[model samples]
Target: MTLTKTFNHVDYLWDDAHATSLGDDQVALFLYRSNILGADLRITNYGGGNTSCKTIEKDPLTGEEVEVMWVKGSGGDIGTLKRSGIAGLYTGRLRALKSVYGGLEDEDRMVGLFQHCIYDLDSKAPSIDTPLHGLLPFKHIDHLHPDALIAVAAAKDSEQVTKDIWGDTMGWVPWQRPGFDLGLQLERCLAENPGIRGIVLGSHGLFTWGDTSYESYINSLEVIEMASEYIEKRVAEQGDKVFGGEKVKSLSPEARKNQAAKLMPLLRGLTSSHARQVGTFQDTDKVLQFINSYDLQRLAPMGTSCPDHFLRTKIQPLVLELDPQEDLSDREVILAKLEGAFAKYREGYHQYYEKHKRANSPAERDPNPVIILYPGVGLFSFAKNKQTSRVASEFYINAINVMRGAEAITEYTSLPRQEAFDIEYWLLEEAKLQRQPKEQPLSRKVALVTGAGGGIGKAIADKLVAEGAVVVLSDINKASLEEAHATYGRDQSTYAVCDVTDMASIEGALDAAALAFGGVDIVVHSAGLAISKPLEDHTEKDWDILQNVLVKGQFQLAQASVETMRKQGTGGDFISIASKNGLVSGPNNVAYGTAKAAQQHMARLLAAELGKDHIRVNTVNPDGVIIGSKIWEGAWAEGRAKAYGITVDELPAHYAKRNLLNEIIRPEDIADGVFACVGVLTKTTGNIINVDGGMATAFVR
Candidate 1:
C-alpha cells in the first residue's frame, strides 16, 4: 500500500527509505513507528501510548531462537524512546500467565508475574498495558490515544459510532481498567471478529496491528483519519452551535498575556500551599476559544476523558470565577474571588478523595488542581518543573480537541469518577511514584540573576540552576548575555539584556522571568562596577557611575521584583552582592566604598520593610573577588594596586594575605555565599555573609 495519504488532521511521516535503512530489524522499525506516531500530539500525548512487536531472538540461556515481545516500557515517552527503554519478555511465558489468571481480582498479582517472563535480564520493566499486547496474536501492535479517535470513543454513543465509522472492520470494547482482564477482552474481540483491522477502546484510545510494522502503522493512521473526517463533517454542520457558541470574547494578544502574567503568580502561590510548583502559561487560539465558550462552565467541570489527560492535568481544572469583560485592574476584588475559588476547589477535591478512596489507596495527593483556567486568559499549568508543566498544558489542549469533536457530533463523556479514581490511586501507580528520584534542593524555584554575563553573575546563575532552579540570565551586555545563555541552553535558563540603571530594562527582565518560568522566586543583584579613587581625585562621573550601577541599580531591580513576589504571595529572596569596603574604610576607594555601603544599608532597610510580605533581603560582602572580576580588568585594578604600593599582578596575593584565612576568593566563593543565603539561610535576612575568607575588618558588627 502507498504510504502517502491526504488527511485534514495528523501527518503521514513515514519514510520508506528510512525504514529500509534499519535492514529488517523489527525492534528498530518498532521504535521508528512509535516515534513517528508520538511526534504529533494529535496522535498520542507524551508517555501516553505503548507499542510492541513480537520478535525472534536468541535466548541467552537456551541458545535457541525464541519468540520475545519488545514493548515500550513503563513511564517512557515513545518520541524519545531508546533501546534501553524497551522491555523484552518471553512470549511463551507471557501467554502462560493466562492459565494462572484468577480473573479481575488477580490483575495486581499478574503484574508481578511478568518479571518471571523476562527474556532480557537488563530489559526495562514492562508497563501495565503489557497484557494488552502480549495476548494479541499480531506480530506488531500500535495502541495510541489520538484525539480524533478518542472523540469517537468518548462520545455518548461511542460503540455505535465505532460501528458506523469502520462498519465491522473495527471492534469496540467498553471501558475496563488496563490489566489482564482488559487484555483478555481484546483477545476475545479479535477472536470473535476474525477480519477486524483494529479496535476502538471506549473512552480510552485505539489499537491497530498487522503482520508487519509498516502495515500496523498505516492501519492506525487510516482509522484515525477516517474518524477525523467524520468528526469534521459533523462539526461543520453544527457550526457556531459547537460548545453552545462563544459566550465571551477573547482578549487582545497583549491584554491576554499581561493578564496571564498577573494571574500566574497568584495561582502559583495558591496552588503551592502543599509544595512549591513551577508554572507554564499557554494562550493558543483553540485554548481561548474553549475558555471563552458558553459551555466552558459545564464542560470544564466534567473533567478530561482519557487517563493520560487527567493523570497530567488532575481530575478537573480550577476555573476562576472572574468575568473577562469586567475591569481586571481591581486587584483586591480579583484576590478575594481567587481566594474563594481556590478554597472551594480544594474542598471539592477532598470530597472526591473521600468518595472513591479504597482502604489500600495511597494517601490523598496535593488537593490543589494541576490545571487552572481563566475565561479570558487561557490556561496555566503547574508542576515540579518547566517541561512537565508545559507538557501538562499540551495534554489539556488535546482534551479540548477531543471535547470539541465529541460535543459537536455527540455528547462528550468522561470516564466515570470511580473508574478514574481506581486508575489514579492504583497501588501499582503509587509504587511507581515511590521509585522516582528525590527532588533537588532548589527544585520548583525560579531565579533571576542580573549581570549573568560576567564572572560572579555567571557563577551565581550556574550554581542556582545546578541546584534545580530554573533561571533567567539577564545582563546589560547583549554579547555576554548571549554567551551565558548558550552555556545553560533554553531548558534551564533564558536570557534578557538588562541595564539596571534603566527601570524599563529592569522591568522587562522581570517580565521575561515571569513569562519564561511563571515568576521569580529569587533575585541576585550581582551587577556592579568599581571606581577606585581618593576623595579629591573622584570625578563627578565616577561617583555617578558607581552610585547608579551599584546603589540605584539594586534598588530598581528590587522594586520590580517585589511587585511580582507580592502578587505571587509567595515569600522570596533578594541578595545584594556588596563589597567589604561597605563596612571597612579603605583609601582610593571613596566612591566605590560609599556606593557599596549604600547598597548594603538599602538591603537592611528593605529587609525590615518587606518582612511582613515574607520577602527576605540579605547582602553578601566579598573583600577581593579579583581573579575573574570584570570590575578588576580595568583602571579600578591599577588604582587599587597603586594605593597599596603593589603591581596589579600582586593584588590577589596581597588581598589573600590580609584576610585571616589567607585564601584567595574566587567568583565561585561569592556564588557559594549567595547559595547559602537562599538555600541554607532560609531564616536569615538583614545580615551580611562575607565570602572573603574570614576578613575580620568586614565582619558584621
Candidate 2:
C-alpha cells in the first residue's frame, strides 16, 4: 500500500528522485535507506541498529551468480555507513549453517563460522546480528531501535499491545540475546505467520522488511508513525499523571546550570576512583521532567529495557540522594550527602556483579554508575571519553522517553537482571572491548588554553587535542577564535571568549569548559602581550598593560581554575607559557621583562601552595620564537630588531644565530615543551623547561 498518511512525530525524508537516481544498485539503495533512517535520533540512536539487503552477485572465485547479503559490519554506525563499512556474505552458506548449529550453547561458536561465508574477503568483519538479517526471507530488511516502538516493546503487556496495534499484520517474539539462536527464532516466526509485514521483538526493537528498498523504508516509517500516534494519544489521556506527577519543582535554568557546574567536577572525581572518566551534563526539558517526578526513585532503579540503551548507560543510573530544593544551596550538606551516596553506589554495583556473574564471565568492570540522575538538577553521564559520555547521556534520555510512553499506557518493564547480566558480560562483547584501539595519553582529560586563537596558544591546544584531550580554546579575538575552533571536530574542541585579566571573564571560560566536557584537568596560561621600549621611553600605560595581561592575568586565571581542580580532587597540571625574558635582563624591554619575571614567580608560589591539592604547576620558557608568534607580528618585532640594529625581516635569522644551537624556534617547538610537562613529566612538578634552542643566558640559576 502507498504511504500517504501524514506523520505527526517522525519526518518523511524520502525523496523520490534520490531513490530513482540510485536505480537497481541494491547495496547502494540499502545504504541510502539506512542513512536516512539513522539521521533522525527518533528513528534510532548512533550505532544502535543494523540494516541489510540481499543482492545477486557473481562470485569472484566461481564466476557464477549467487545470492549475497550486505549488512552493517561490527562496530559500524548506519548513520555514517560507507561501502567499506559493510560486510558481504554468501547468503546460501549463512542459511546452511542451521544444520550444524549446536543449539543455544553454540551461539558464540556460530559467530565464528560466519567469517568463512564471506563473499568478499576485503569487506569489514560481520557483526553478531549478521544471521538475523541473512536468514530473513526478504530482499530488504530494517532492524531499528526507535524509542516509540521500544516503548511499546518494553511495556508490561508488550505482546498484547502488538496484537492490539496491528492485529495479524505484525508478529511478536519474546526477549532473546542477539545471536544465532535469536535469528532462528525470527525466521521461525515469519514461517509460522505468513504475510505478516513485521515483528516487534519484546524489550528489544522493531523488524520490518519488503520486496524493494523503497518499500522497506516506507514500511519501517509507517510502523513507527502508527506507534508514535498510539503513544501520544495514550499520553494525552494520562495527562500530568505521567511519572506520577512532579515531586519537586525544577530549578530555574541559571540556578540548575550553576548547580550542575558545581557538582560535575565532584561527580567526575568520585566516579573516577578506579579509572579517570570524562563527563557530559544534560539539563534538557525531558531530563528535568524525569528527575523531578515522584516515581523517579522507583522507575530509574528498574533500569533501561533495551540492550542498546543499557549497553551505553549501564543497567541503571545512580539517583543522587539529596533534596534539590533544600540542599542545592548548601554546599556542605550537598558534599556530605554526595560522598555517602557514591560510597553506597560502589558497594551496590559490586554486589550486582557478584550476584549475576557466571564462572566464565569476564571479570567485573569498574564499580561505578555510568549515568547519574540529580533531582531538580539534571543528568550526568561519564565514560572513557567525551563522545561516549555524551552519547550515553543521549541513550539514557532515549530510555527516559521509552519509559514515559510505556508508563502512559501499561507499566514500564526492564529486562530481567539475569538476562541483563548475561548480555553485559557476554564473552563476545568483551572481545569487542578488547579490540578497541588503545587510548592516547591525554584520553579522558579536559584542558583550557588561554589565548588559543593563534600562535603558541593554538599550537599547545592542537597538541593536547592530538593526544586525546577535549579542549576549550579561549581567546579575546572572536574572528581568530572561530577560525581556530573550526580546525577541530565539534567534539574535540570548543571556543570561548575571555579576557584573562578579568576574573568574571576567566570564570566564564571555566564554566564553558565544565559545561562542554565536565571540568578542566589541564590549564595552560599562554595569553600575553609584550611592550618593548627603552627604560627612559617606557610609559606607565605600557607598564600597566603588560603586567595586567601577562602577570596579573596568569594569577587570576590560575586562581579561578584551581577551585574547579580542587573540586574534582583529581590531580591536574597548570603549565605557564612563560618566557626566557623572565630570567634574562635585556635592554629596551623593561616593562615586558618585569611582567614575565612576575609571571614565573607567581607560578612557583601557586605550585607550592596548591601542592597539597595535587595540582602541579610548571612553566615552559621560549625565546625569540619569531615564526608564528603573535607578539612578534606587532611593534615588538620592530622594536627588538631596532635595538639589535637589524631589520624586522632579519630578526628571525638574527635570533637563530644568537642561540647556542643556532636553530630557529617555531610555535610548534614551544608546544612540544608544554606537552612534555603535561603528558611525559607527570611526576615532576614546579619546574621549567626551555624551548629556546639552548640559550645559555636564559639558563635557570
Candidate 3:
C-alpha cells in the first residue's frame, strides 16, 4: 500500500448511513473511523460521513476554562466541516459519570449531564459521545467504516486477513453498540496495543488518531486509502456491476445519446434538475460494484457507510427482484413478486423498530425500497436526484461484492439490527433536530452576485444556490462571465456583463439577468478592485481610482439590484465586499484599505435605512484571497514584490502568515461566507464576516 498521499481531498461518505450523531471529538471520529476501518464500509456523498472535533475553551458565562469538546454538527457533511459545525461538550463532568446505571432515569437528567461544560448556555448540546469521548484516554480519535475497509472486515477471516495486511499496527475488536461497551472495549484495546496507529471494530468500523487534527485527518485518509486498495484488488478478482450499474452492453455514442434522452425524461423528477446528464466510468471496479448491489440488506448493512446517511439517501433503497431473463410472458408475475417484497420489507422494518426503540419518534420517511434489482438483470437505486442515486448505488454495490468475497470463508452475517435501531434512534444524536430553526432558512430569497468569476464571489454564489435560491452572475469581463455561466449556470442561474462603477453597465446586466431567470432575489456586491500600495508612493489619482472601483462600484450594483429584489415583495438582500482593513486597518494598503473600510460601514448604514423595507444588508471582509482573480496575481506583480523586500514567492507567505489558518485564503472561501449571510443566516443583519483565514484572529490577539 502507498504510505502517503497529499491532502486537499474531501467527500461525503454518509450518503449510505441512517444512523449518525453530533457528539464529542472522539465519538465523532469514532463514527467516521467506522467507515474507514474496513472494506465493507464506505462514506461517499456531497454530504458524506459525519465527524466532529473537540477542545477546551473558556466558558463564556464563567469566563473560566471549561472542558469543551466540539463534535460534528448535524447538517454540515463531514467532508466539508468548519469550526462551528461541531457541537460543543463539557468533558469534565462527562468523565465523572460512568454509565446510565442509576442517574435520573428520564432523558431530561441526561440532558443536564454536561451542563457544566457549555461555552454558552444557549449554545447547542454536546455530541452523543460526550460520555464516551470523555472516558477515552486518546486526546484525538476517529471512527469510520470506510467501504473499502468494511468490505475486508465484514468477512469471516477479517481479523486474520487484516493481520496479514497491516501486521501489528492495527487492533480488531468485535462490533458492539457504540456506547459504554464499545468505548470500554476500545480502551482495553489501546491498553493492549499501545503502539496502535488505528483500530478496526469487527462488523462495525475503523479508528485512527494523532496528537493534532491535521495529523489525524491525514492518517485517516491514508489508512482508509490502503484498505480501499485492498478491497479493489479483491473485488477485481471477484465481482461485476458498478455505480454506473451493470451495463446491459456498451452502446455506440449515437445510440447512447438517444438512450440518454429517453432516460433523462424518465429520471427528471428524481432530483432538482429534470434534464438528463451523460457520464461514463470504467475500470474502477469499486465504483462499478458500488453501483450494482441489489439487496444491500442481504449483502451487508449498506444503508450508510456511517450513521448519518439518513439525511442524504433517506432510510433505504428500493429493492426489486429479477426473473427469467427475456421472459416477457412472466412480466405480470414479476410485478406481483416486486409488490410482495416491498410489503415484507416494510412490515419487517416496523417490527425491528417496535422491538428495540425506547426513545424519540422516528421520522416517517419514504420506504419504497430504494434498491431495484432484477436478480439476473441488475440493480438500480432510487432517489430524488441522480447524484444521490449514483452515490447510494456505488456504496451498496461495493459492500455486496465484498460480502460475496467473505462468503468464501464462512457464513455471512450482519451487525445486530436491534442495536442499529438504537443508534438510528439515538437521543443524543437527536438534539440537532430539536434545536433546528423554525424557517426553511432560505425561505423567501433570490440573489445576484457580481464578479462571480471565481474564488470568493463564486463561493458565495455557490452558497446562495445551495440554499434554494436563484443567482445571477454579473461581471464586465465576458470571458469571466462565460466561465461562471458554464460552471454554475442552470435553471436557477444566469450570467450578465456589467462593469460596476458604470450605471448603464449595471442597468443592462440587471435587465438581462432578471428577464432570463425571474428577478433578483438578493444582491451580493462583490465586484471590486484591490490595489495594494504604500502611503508614501500613493497619489491622488490612486486614491480616486481605489474609491471609485471599490466603493462606488458596489453602490451602483446594490442600487439597481436592490430595487428589483425589493419588487419581489419579499424584501431584498444587499451585501458588499469589504476587507479587514476596514475593521482594523492593514499595513501599506493606504488607498485600498481606506476604501475597503468605508465600504463596510456603508453597508452597515444601508442595513439600518433598509430595515424599513425588510431588506437585509451586510458586508464581507476577507483577507489576501487568491481566488482566480487578476488582483491576486497583481498583488505581487513585479516591482511591488521587490519593494516588499522579499521574493515574489515570499509575498503571499508574508501575507498568509498574518492569518490564523496560516494559508492563503481563496476567493471562493470568502464567497461562501457571503452566501451564508444571505442563505443560512437570513435573519442576520449588519454582519461582517472576515474571510481572512484567521488574520482577524491575529488582530484580535
Candidate 4:
C-alpha cells in the first residue's frame, strides 16, 4: 500500500537533545504522540486505541540493560495520559512466560501472567496487547481502531482493497480474536512482510510502527487518510444509488421529551436488573440523521462498525420501531407497542447469550441492550449513568457514520456473530470488569426534583448527586433551571421547565426525568409558595395561588410519579418539602397555613395508598430555611420581616434565635433531612421530619 510520510502534528516533535538526553526518551515520545493521536476523533475516540514504546532499563538483579515495552495502562485515556499511564514490562519476562503457558486458555491466568511480566511491580497493569508490542522489533508501535481504517479492513474484499491502495506498504493479518494467539499471529505477519509500514487486522483495526514515535503516528494518519480518500472517491463514482437519502420527521423537543418520559420508565423497569440508567441522544444531528435515513432498517442491524466497537457497543444494537403512521402522542398505544418489542428483544438477548457462552465464561454482560435505535425518535443509550450513556451514544453515532461510508463503497459488512461473541466475552474485558469499584448507596438510582432552580430544590439535587443518584432538575423558570444545571454540572444532571399547577406539565416533567435517567427512584416535591395575608384581607386569587401550588400540584406530582414507580416495579421515595406552618400557625398566615396543612395531609393519605406498592412518602417540614431560598425573596421577605417586627436584614436571625436550638437553618439542612429520609430512614415513612433546628411548636409527635 502507498504510505504517506508527512507528519501532521509538528508540536509533538522533540529536539535531538531532549529525545536522547532522557534515558526514557522513547516513553516520553510515546506519551506525546498518544495524546496527539487521541486528540483527534478521526484517529481514535475515547479510550479505544493503545500505544507503546520499546526501551532498555537496567535489570535490578542482572545489572544489565534489558528490553522493556512501555504500553498504555488500563483505564487511562490516551488524551490525558501521564508518565504513570505507561506500564513498563520486561520483554524477556513475557517471552519466558510464553513457553510455560502450556496452552492454558484461561483469561484470568493470562491476565496474571501479564501482570507478573511488569518490569516494575508497582507500575500499572499493562494492556492485554503487551505480547504483541513486545514481539515486534520496532522501537515504537501504535494500535488504533479508527473508523475510516475499519471501513477498509472489515470489508469482504479487504485484502484486494489493501493491495489496490497501498500495494506492499501494508500487510494483512486475518481476523483473529485478540489474545496470546493473535499476538503470535502478529509476530508472524511482521517476520513474513519485512519493512512494512503498517498492518491491517481484518475485522479489527490498524497497527503501525517505526524507529521513532513520530514515524509510527504519521504512518497511522497516512493510512487512515488514504482509506478515507478511497471511500469518498468510490462514493462519488457510485452517486447516491449506493445508499438511500430519505427524509425523516422528528417530534418537537417538548413532544419528544414527553414521549421519552412515558416510555423510558418502561424500558428501565424491564431492564432494571441490568441497565440502571438510560439517556437519550435524539437531539444530536448525527443520531437524528441515522434514524431518519431511508435505509435505516437495512443498515442498522448489520452489527458494529468495527470489532473493537463490540467492546463498547454490543454486536448488534436493539432496533425498535415506532409507527410513523400512528400518532406518537397516544401514550397507551405507544407503550403497548414498546412492551411487545421489549419482550422480543429480551428473548433474543437471552438466546444470543445461551448460544455463545462457555462454562468458564463470566456471567453474560447485562442482557439489556446498550444501544437502542428507533425511527420516529432518535437513539437512546442505556447505562449506569447519564455520562456513560452519552459516551455510548457518541460511539454509536460514529459507528453510523462509518457504516454509511463503508456502504457507499460496498455493502457494509462486519465480523460474523461468533467473532463478535468472542470479543464480547473476551478475557481482557472480563479483567476490566473485575476491577470496577463497588456500587454506591444510590448507584443506578434516578431522582426527580421540583423547584430545582434554587433553594431547597437545588440542595436536594446536590445531595442526591453526592449519594450517586442521577438527578433530573425541574422548575417553572427555565433560566434558573439552566443555571442549576451549570452549577451542578450539565453532564451529571438534566433539567425540564415545569409549571406544577398543570397535570400535563407534571407528566412531561416526570417523563423527562424518566427519559433522561431510566426511571425515577426518588421524587422530591419541593415547588411551593406562601402568600401571607390577614383572614379579612385574603382574596380569591391569593387563595387559588397558594392552594394550586402547595395542594393540587402535589397531588398531580404524586399521581404521575406513582404511576411510573409502579410500572418500574421498583419501590421508590416521595418527599414533600412542607412548611412548619402546616402544624403551627401565626397571625396573618391563614391562607399559607391552610394550603400547607392540606399538603401535609395529602402526603399522609398518598403514603398510605402507595405503601402497598412499596413507595415511601414523607414530608420534610422545614421552617426558617431562608438563606439562599427563593421562598423568602422580594415582597415575601419584606412581609416576613414585618411580621417579626424587624428589618429585612434581621429577619433571618429572628427566626434562628426563636428556634429551640438557636441555629440558622440553611437550605442544605433541609436537604440533609431529605437525604436521611431516603437513605438512613429507609423503614421510616408516612411521617414528618422537622428541619427547623428543633422548632418545639411545630415538632411532630
Query: In candidate 1, what are the lDDT values of residues 451-495, reduced to their tens digit?
Result: 899789999998998999999999889999888888875569888
Give candidate 1 regions above 4 Å deviation.
Answer: 1-8, 15-20, 325-330, 641-664
Q: What's the TM-score of each model vs. the native?
A: 0.94, 0.97, 0.49, 0.87
The residue-level lDDT of candidate 3 at 96 comes to 57
Q: In lDDT terms, which candidate is top?
A: 2
Per TM-score, the best of the predicted structures is 2
Q: Residues 205-274, candidate 3: write the lDDT tens digits.
A: 6777776544566667777766756555654554453322353333444433333222221221121122
lDDT of 4 by residue, 1-701 (tens): 33334434222333445445555577888888888788776667777778888888899988999998888887777877888877888888887766766553653476578877878776877766777778778889888877777777767678888888789989998887666667777889888998888888876788898887767877777788788788778867866444576456777667665556566766667666554565555556657667777778787767775755766777778777764444644556666887787778777877888998877667776777778876666677777767677767767776876776677656677777777776678666786878988867777778899999998899999998998887889999999998889976646688889988999888878767776676788999999887766678889999999889989889889888898887777789999998999999797788899889998998899889888989999999999878889888867777777777789889789988999999999999999999999988999779899999888889777
Pairs with steric clashes in candidate 2: none
Winner on TM-score (1 vs 3): 1
Q: Write the per-residue lDDT of candidate 2 for residues 130-150, one digit (tens) a residue.
A: 999998989999999999999
- Global lDDT of each model? 0.90, 0.91, 0.57, 0.78
Assess candidate 4 and give its TM-score to the true structure: 0.87
lDDT of 2 at 136: 95
